[model samples]
Target: MTATRPLLDPAAARRRYVRVCVLFWLPLGLTIAPLVLLLTQRGLGLAAVAGLTAVHSLTAAALELPTGGLSDVLGRRAVLAAAGLLNLAALTLLALGTTPWPLALGMALMGAGRALSSGPAEAWYVDTVQVHGGPGADLRTGLARGSSATSAALAAGTLLGGALPWLLRLGPDLGAATSGRVLPLSVPLLLGAAVYVAFVLHALTALPEPPRPPATLRGVLRGVPGTVLDGLRLGGRDAVVRRVLLSAAAAGGALAALELLTPGRAAALTGASESGAVLFAGLACAGFVCAGLGSHLAPLTARVAGSGERAVLLALGAGACGLLLLGAAPTATGRFSVLLAATGYGLVYLGLGAAGPNQNDALHHRVSGAVRATALSVQSLALQLAGALAGLAVGLLPPGRLPWLLGGAALLSAALLWCRRAGHLAPPDVSSPAEAVRPGVRTDAGEGQRLL
Candidate 1:
């Protein structure tokens, strides 16, 4: 008989949560500030850069379901470690490559890594806690902490990545000696690769997977595809899951527009690439800090609003308002324009941060351990799909119109939440043909039907 694994207690859950936060977020944050700017600096145009980003999203979208299913079938630790390895290789390529095709290739690899890492850690945490504390385990507190930690990591990494290139300039002049071979902007990406190596090592050493049937190559091949199909059916058939997925897609569009437009705006406002990098970095840091604060406030927001759905509506509404402000900021003069842009940017992050845990909590309530990671992947696929479309659209449009378009979409997304409130909600239908074959281990309908 297979040996039963020991259950994870609260303290162990907390430890796993922290590890997930650090491993998943810190490396990504380290490269965010300079990623677009570095591409532009390396001679790609704005449209090309956007296309590269779309490629990343496309790659991630393609792999999201399969990778998630792989985690469910095999184990979270193994998949997470594999993601770290892919990321390390991708980061190295990003730092060293000098051409557009090479850069695009790196981004594609990074996307695969992203898809793999997306849900496994959180799945692991939820599975552990459920095994120990049962279905009623408090998830919001841990999820909130994880979200806040992610934001904090982004904040620190943005600040550091933004300043590192400028800081490197302070050292002895390498431009002349190296014949302009050493680009300061590439330093952070290389550093990020080192961090990725560390994360992989840490994941291997620290993350413990609950014992299950040892997965064979054949089993993995057969099981993963089946799990992916089941996950897709659940997402399509379940009302709450469907709503959350839609919300994620809307968020992706909003974020894609912001990311595509903001760096260029900062560069234009600052009037130089180096100064633009610094300006964008500082603004990104501030935005991430605001996001952390918003995540910290998620539970409180839910409490205040009397329901999670209402809180999502409020947060999305705030985000829409911020995007509208951003759309109008360019019309203003001097310092006011800068201030408005910063405020709008911060508010957008804040709203998204607040919405994240709430939506994930709702998702968690509907999915069981068997398909949890797969469900999260389905959500991620939606986000990446929307982001890819938004990136392509924003790339083709004039920068001035991008924010307005995204703001309208955000409003439409918020409007969706209003259509279903209070008692109108129903438990997910697990009786569908596909789900009946692989029924969810947990029936969350009892708590899921509750107001908040």
Candidate 2:
């Protein structure tokens, strides 16, 4: 006789949640400090980098829904394993390849891995929690913990990744001998690949997929398309989900604008290529730390503002102000102005971080487990699609005007979150009221569901 799986206890759920957060983010974070500088160091131009980024986003956008449905049908654990394998290949190519085409190929692989990984881990967490703790299980705290863990991992990995190249440079002979062609910059990506290897092994052993009908190729093909259609329909039928997705797209545009502009700005401020890379790395680390702080404070922000929608609006407003400050910094002449720009950078991450868990919490309440991963993938697709457009457009604009344009777009996004009348529309088409409203708690549609 086969042994039965145990129901997920609170302690077991917490361990899995933290595992998913660390494994998913740590590999990506390891590359953040060196990625752009490494490309430029390999003779890629600004336009080329923009093109590569757009390609990555487009690739991820194309695969998002299909991969989500694959996870929904096949299994989250299987899909996550595939993602890890792909990352191993992608990161190897990225670390070793020198030319643009080679790097582009690596980017393509990375995008596919990203799409596969996006929702499966989170879906697993939600499903496992609901199975043990019931549909009315408190998700905001768990989601926040996952979000904060991701940010914290990024912060620590970025700090370490940034400092490694500098330290390696100090011992030039040994560094060249060990790292070969790509030198200090490529070291982090190589290390990231090793992390992916470990991530795959850990995921295979640690995560237990919920039992479903046995998966067949025919089932996957038939089931996935139907799942995609249902997920798309859900977005159309629900006004809140539609608004949340649009807001995600706008946030994507803002993020693209920042990622494109900021490193170049850092390079200008520091006046040395190597020094700039290190400085940008440090700043990126600081930004991620600030983001973690924002996520940790999200529930408090919601409670204080009286609604998730209002909190989202307030956070976006802060982001817009930060962008405006960044835009203004160039006109001023002082080291203090540079410091102001840095502060603005941190603020943007803070605002974006605060908005994420709130938006996701709203989305989770509006949907059912049957299409959970697909729905999350739809949200991710919106972000990637807008980011692809923003990457191309932001690269074309003069640096001075970029932040203002992005800030305006963010302001418009915040406007969409405003609901004139706070009332219910019969709690959507969710399977149970507990799915939309937390157990015994009553919530208004416009204000969003209260999780805390």
Give Cα-based local distance difference scores for all models: 0.78, 0.76
- Candidate 2 vs. true structure, TM-score: 0.87
Top lDDT prediction, candidate number? 1
lDDT of 1: 0.78
CA deviation > 4 Å runs, candidate 1 = 1-5, 36-54, 98-104, 172-182, 267-277, 396-406, 422-452
| Candidate 1 displacement at residue 348 in angstroms | 1.2
lDDT of 1 at 25: 79
lDDT of 2 by residue, 162-182 (tens): 778878788766435755566
**TM-score of every candidate:** 0.87, 0.87
* Local error of candidate 1 at residue 47 (angstroms): 6.5
245-350 in candidate 1: lDDT tens per residue? 8888888888888877887878888887778767777887888898898888988998998877788888877887778888878744379888888888888888
Q: After superposition, how far is residue 184 of candidate 1 from its true place, in Å?
A: 2.9
Clashing pairs in 1: none
